[model samples]
Target: MPTGVALHDVRGQLFDAAERVLVREGPSALTSRAVTLEAGCAKGVLHRHFADFDDFLAELVRDRVARIDGHAAALRESAGTGTVTDNLTRVLPDLFDPVAVAVVSLVTSRDGLRARLREARPVGVPILTDAATAIASYLTAERELGRIAEDADVGTLAPTLIGAAHMLFADRQGVPPEAEDIGKVVNAVIAGVR
Candidate 1:
């Protein structure tokens, strides 16, 4: 007798394949046929798993955002032991690293993929903003404890700092900061709080 698999199992495999294709070939290469082929299934397999390519791409963005949010949560949970700057230094590199840059570039470029990203915006924005807020909150706490300048505008500063990290990682101009260099930049930004 032949073995059988559940529908959800097959659907998960299709999504997994779509992720690999998006990560490896960028958004332009993602198509129903491509994803089905990558998943080692019939052409209709992708449609059965997803209503269409747009649906697949939407799920992809959601999945990536969730992963990033989870990482941010882990960092936030461990942030108590270190200085605000120290915790940020430890976390930003992983969040805005080269692989993440590549993923962002792909998602933001294709129209269908971009629409999916927009659909996921409600979830993604809060995840990203929460990470920024966590950093800002840490800064605010440090200020209260007298470790940082009392008048510092952490609300504005945190997003600026995160934006800078994003730029550095996405710097296609080939002048992106090294990890140590990013540390220096972050430290300088935090130090200028006064």
Candidate 2:
């Protein structure tokens, strides 16, 4: 940021900056001041745009959750271009990125933040739940095309796969699960039911 230069905030810029701060420095480092500094804007910019820091943080979490939902729902984007397993394996990685992991950790540990988020979205759609639902819908579509077994229990399998994914990468101390690891898990889950 050049001295005295006015930098306009593009939508999501502050959110991206906050995510970066969380990933690099941890949740305690994510203040509105830090985000504005990272975003190269005035400190008051965040307050001006949002009711307060909690509202802004909730929005960021909401945005990431929505992004995950969008990504899960876009399973068809790879339809016909790759095997069903391949498409699902690709989408699975989006759930375990460092930024997302940090956000999840931060939100779950803070009751106030959690309450703010729930208030912001009254329907109380958990991101993981939405991801599982979207994954099931995709699997159902594939099953319709004979990719999955007709008797496959999609409802049970969806969350099982998602839960497996969460366990594999949600651990902060371990090395993040690689694509091969995710592929093995996805294959096993699909094979057991499909």
Task: Give per-residue lDDT, candidate 2, residue 162.
Answer: 86
**lDDT for each of the candidates?**
0.67, 0.78
Candidate 2, residue 26: Cα displacement in angstroms equals 2.3
- Each model's TM-score? 0.73, 0.83
lDDT of 2 at 141: 82
Candidate 1 C-alpha error for residue 104, in Å = 1.5
Residues 41-61 of candidate 1 have per-residue lDDT tens digits of 777666766787777766765
Which candidate has the highest TM-score of all? 2
- What digit string (tens of lDDT, one per residue) describes model 2 on residues 1-194? 33565556544888888988888888877787899899888777778789888888888887888888668657855555578778888888786677777887778776778888776555433566677887888888887777778888889898889888877877665688888899999998898655
**Model 1 regions more than 4 Å off:** 1-8, 97-99, 119-134, 137-147, 171-178
| Model 1 poorest ten-residue lDDT run | 1-10
